[model samples]
Target: MSAPLLAIEDLSVTVRTDEGHAQIIDRADLVLRPGSIHGVVGESGCGKSTLIKAVLGLLPRRSTIDRGRILFEGQNLLTLPRESMTREVRGRAIGFIPQDPFQALNPVFRVGDQMMELLRWHGLPGESPPSRGRIDRTTRARHRAHLISMLGAVQLADAEEALERYPHQFSGGQRQRLLIAAALACGPKVILADEPTTALDVTTQLQILKLLRDLAETFGLSMVFVTHDFGVVAQLCDTVTVMYAGQTVESGPVASVLGTALHPYARMLLACHPDRAADLAGIPGAVPSPLAPPSGCRFHPRCPEARDACAAARPATREPAAHHSVACVLHDEPATATATR
Candidate 1:
C-alpha cells in the first residue's frame, strides 16, 4: 500500500510526578493510511489517549518524549519546532475532536466566535482578514456563511441559529456535531477523535458514528479513532490496534485481529464485547499503574496464556497470519504451529 499518512515509531512518553518519572506510553507504534479509519482500543489508562496526544503534540507540560519519532506526511513531528508545530501541524494538518465537548468549547463565547477564531488561525477557505483587529461587516457575513456551510456538513440543524447560541444550549450530540464542524472547518487531512461518542445516548452515538464514517469517505479524511467499544471498531475502522499497559499487544485488519486475535489480552478484550451470544466477561485485573508497570510483558500478570518466558522478557511482535501481528509469546513459535488459546 501507500506510505502511511501518519506513523508513530517506537514512541515512549514519560510524565513527572511527585514520586518520579512515569512512563505513560511505551514503545507504541501505529500507522494511519489515507482515507481510512484506524481504531485504537484499550481499557482506560492504557495510554490510548496519551498515544494520540503525543501525535497531536498536545502532551501535558510535565510530559517528555523519552524516545521515538512521530512522522506526519514525511516530516518528524517530534523534531518540529514549537512555533512551526503550532502554526502548521496542530489544526491545519491534524484536527482533534475532544471527548468532552463542553470542555472543548468556551462556555462564555458564542459557538460561532470559537469556530471563526479557528478558521482565521488556520486560514481555511472563506477566511477574511480583520482590519486593525476589527472584523468588517462583509468579512463577518462571509465567515457566518462559511460557518453555516460547515455546520450543515456535519448535519447540524438550524445552522445559522446554532452558531449564535452557547455550547450549553445544545444537546450533547449537537455539541459533538459542532465540535466536528469546527474540526472540519480547517479541512484537516487527519482527525483524531478521542471517545467522541462516549457521552452520548445510544441513538445519538450511532448518528455520530455514521456522521464520522460519512465525513471520512466524503472528504478522504484519515481518522485515528480512540474508543473502548469493539462495536464501534467493527463498524468504523479498517484496521485495529489493541493497546495494553502502554504497549501495542495486537494490530491488524479489524476482521483478522478481532476474529482470530493471537494475543491473550486481545482475546480477553474481545470476549468482553457483548455482541456475541456468549456471556460477557471482563478482563480479570485492572490496568497496571504506569508509574510501575509490570516487568517484561505488562500484561503477564493478567494474561491467561502467559508462560514463564513472558515474565522473563518482553515478547517481540510476531506475525502469525497475513496482515496480523501480535506481541505475545504464544506467537513466537513457528507459523506452522498453532498457538495455545
Candidate 2:
C-alpha cells in the first residue's frame, strides 16, 4: 500500500466556552491515501466537523490544538507558520468545500468575482510567483478561460453566462457545484468536504455525490468527506473512519468496516441506516458533553457491549483483520483465542 497522503495522529482540540474548556476532539487518528476518498462518519456533535477544521487551520478563535500532529505530505500542518499555511497550503495544496454553499459564497458579489479573487490570491495552480496582477488583456483572458473551464468541468450549465450572476442566481445544487469548481480551481492535491450535500434535496444530493466521485477520479485527487450518512459513505468512500464523541472508534476499508464492524458503536450506527433497519431507529441516549465526557470510552454509556473495563480506561486499538482497527475492549482477545475458548 502507498504511504498516506495525509495522516492525523492523536489529534486533540479544545474550545473555550462559557462553561470552561471543552475538549471537542480527543486523541483522534485518521489516514488518507493518495487518490482515494475517505469518509468520516458519526452522529452530530461527535466532533466530526471539528476534526476537519483542525486540518485546514480553520478552527474557531477560542479553539486550540492541545496536542498531536496533522501531517500533510511530510510536514506537520500544526507547526507550519501562519503565513506559509495561508500562502502555500490552504486553497493551494489543500482545497476546501464548505457545507453551506449559500453561506460560503458572498451574497453581495458576483460568482465570477469571488472565484477570481481566489485565483488572484493563490495564483492559478502552476504559475510561478502567482499571477497577482493582470499585466495585460491576455493574462485576464487566461484566468477567465480557466474559470469557465472549471465551471464546465463541474457540469454547471451556461458556464460562461453563469459567471456573470450572483450566488442567489443558482440553484442549491448549482451553488454546490460552484464551490466544487472553486476548490478544484487551484489544482489541489487533497479536497476536504464538510457535509457538502447535507443541504440539498435527495435527488440533488445523489447528483452531487456522483459529481464528487467523478471529479475525484478525473483529477486523481484524494478526499476526506465528512458525513453522518452510512449510505453516503457506502456509495462514495473507498475507506472510512467512525468517530464518536471525538475519538476514532473504528477505521478500515469501507467494505470491511460496513460488512463486519467490530466496534459496538459502529455496528449500532450501521443498524440505524434506513436500508438496514426494519423500522426507523436511532442510537439510544445522547452524545455526552465534551466538558465532562465519560471517564474512559466516550461511547461506553450507550454501548451495549460496554463493560467495567470500558469505563476504567480507554480501550487500546487492535486489528483482528487486516486493514481493520477498532478501539473497543470487545476485540481485546484475539479471534483465534476466543474461538478456541
Model 1 Cα lDDT, one tens digit per residue, 1-341: 87899999999999999988889999998989998899999999999999989988889999999899999999999989997787678987899999987688899999988898876666654343343345657766776788899999999989999988998899899999999998888778999999999889999999999999999998889999999988899999999999998999999999998788888888888788889528979788799988899888899999776677777778899888987888887778655234333
Pull out the clashing pairs in model 2: none
Question: What TM-score number comes out for model 1?
Answer: 0.94
lDDT of each: 0.87, 0.92
What TM-score against the true fold does each predicted structure earn? 0.94, 0.96
The deviation in Å at residue 237 for candidate 1 is 0.7
lDDT of 1: 0.87
